[model samples]
Target: MLLNLLLLQCRAGFESECAAEFMQHCVDVGQSGFPRFDAQSGFVLFELYGDALAVIQAVSFRSLIFTRQWCACLPPFEQLPADDRLSVLLPAMTELPVCAELLAEVPDTTAGRELLPFAGKLASAMAQRLRQQGVMLPRKARADWRMHLFVLSGRHLLLGVSPRRNGSTLEMGIRRLKFPGAAPSRSTLKLEEAWHWFVPRAEWDARLGGGKTAVDLGAAPGGWTWQLVRQGMFVSAVDNGPMAESLMETGQVTHHREDAFGFAPGKPVDWMVCDVADKPARVAELMLQWALQGWCQEMIFNLKLPMKKRYQAVQQCLEEIAEGLEAAGIRFQLSARHLYHDREEITCHLDLRVS
Candidate 1:
């Protein structure tokens, strides 16, 4: 029996966690698969014995916390001649069905970085050749599939495909979000990336723009608060530490010298964002409280995980939140991911919507 493959990209040091999560997901869906990974390699491969595409379809990308991006795999080509790597790759590209776009990527490691320029150049050449061969669809056509070329080195490559509906929106599974210099803290990138992942750019105005009131817990130096202010929303920055004076002067922000866990607003706000340093369970409970109490319609927070059994910790916290929300008769959508900018923690987004 032939097996199919799923390729996943994750943080370099957390390949084991990513592999463990992938295996658990496969088991949860009643699929049989085994994971292949190396610590600090920044990738995982799950080979499924049954209908691999069906298994991939059943798994939601948002639920896989340790994974940054993923794609379905085709047979890999090993040790091509240095002089004509494209010639070796072309046959494989032609064998596949139509693809909307081609993403040329390397592993997220020093070795991978060294091959980036080569991958970029190869991707460009492949796109042109695929178009000429009528193997690539036009931009305006419905994108059924995305081709992924993972360059192991100048001489070796792994080919994969992801259905448009289930794959990363970006070519390489990396969202290249720019960091604004004006933001008071680098941590601001976390919220910015979360919004990009959870909310569509077109819906930003209706869902998170002007007239929306937000509370930023642990808002000292105003990293998260700065994002809110930029959206033209009024923010109550809560913390014992001083916020960025520039952010405070914007007059769009009001600083509250108080504890985040104990603070509550005079009235319910549109959004609540937290980045406080606390135990993962404690942070999860805080998030559940705000949602259950109807303090905010939406929330985005971080959970700092323990050194051991990190995946189990996140799962337990999420289960607890679900039970609390269900008991409170609240309708909500919760999703979490270990963002590229994150270290030793994961970011979660919850939407407390009226049923």
Candidate 2:
């Protein structure tokens, strides 16, 4: 596609935050664009007044926190006849640069879920049509671009393009997981998703395994701790509350009856993970303190977002952390995301070792 606009997917009810962030980023990159989005549309479109190819090249998709998925797009096609929709969809699909992959996606809303059956059928029909048109490569055939068909309803859809390595490979930018029956609480899934998102699989054994040591602050009932233990890492589970007995019997966890905010590891450990429910500023500061003291080489924590000015809160916390690290001459890699398993807060991963 000779794309001129950007379609950004985000969590429903967060369209404003996504729009605000996207606008600021585009401004930073010197790209001018005006945004359009409904209150709960689960998407924001920045119709570019400047060149879109220039804009996407300047603004890395990973730099966006609020946005789940991004694609440079042609304007949406609407009101296709219920029958023979492929005839209408194929023309736009064929005009695109041949993409290595195709994703038929829907908004993460109740209405979108109802169209899942239709989405599947649409994907199959479009793939066959595009194949005949010589516009799409077979799946995983090695190409830089990805094609996305985002469906609003049976009769409406948008065609977009994204760099394969720059954004999520998953459809709809969602990482769905089955909750473990043995896990103590549903909160475990957040940390599990964190590892899945932040860590590349090839480095998992080297960075995440080998009987490494970890500390889980606010680890009562053992949600985050279970993931560490599952990876063969022994954990010092720190919380004032009682832990799940099933985890205790594994002989892998040492439960400490102490306040997480007040506790420190005896020595620097391989990892420190916290899921304490507290103010975002306090949480960011607490994580930084561990970094300054070299208490842990890596840390993952959640910042509970305030109800208002949520985007401002996120930027301030991240900026403070970045400035503190720079002033201390500490080299680090820091990133935050609003993950699928999270609500009202975002997860952060901070590594003291940049490489």
Candidate with the greatest lDDT versus the true structure: 2
Show the lowest summed lDDT stretch of 10 residues, model 2.
51-60
Each candidate's number of clashing pairs is 0, 1
Tens digits of lDDT, candidate 2, 66-123: 8898888877888888988988878877666679778878888888878877887888
Q: Extract clashing residue pairs from model 2.
A: 1-96
Task: State each model's C-alpha RMSD to the native.
Answer: 1.7, 1.4
Error of 1 at 66 (Å): 2.3
lDDT of 1 by residue, 194-282 (tens): 99888889999999986799999989899899999999999999999999989989999999999999999999999999999999999
Clashes (candidate 1): 0
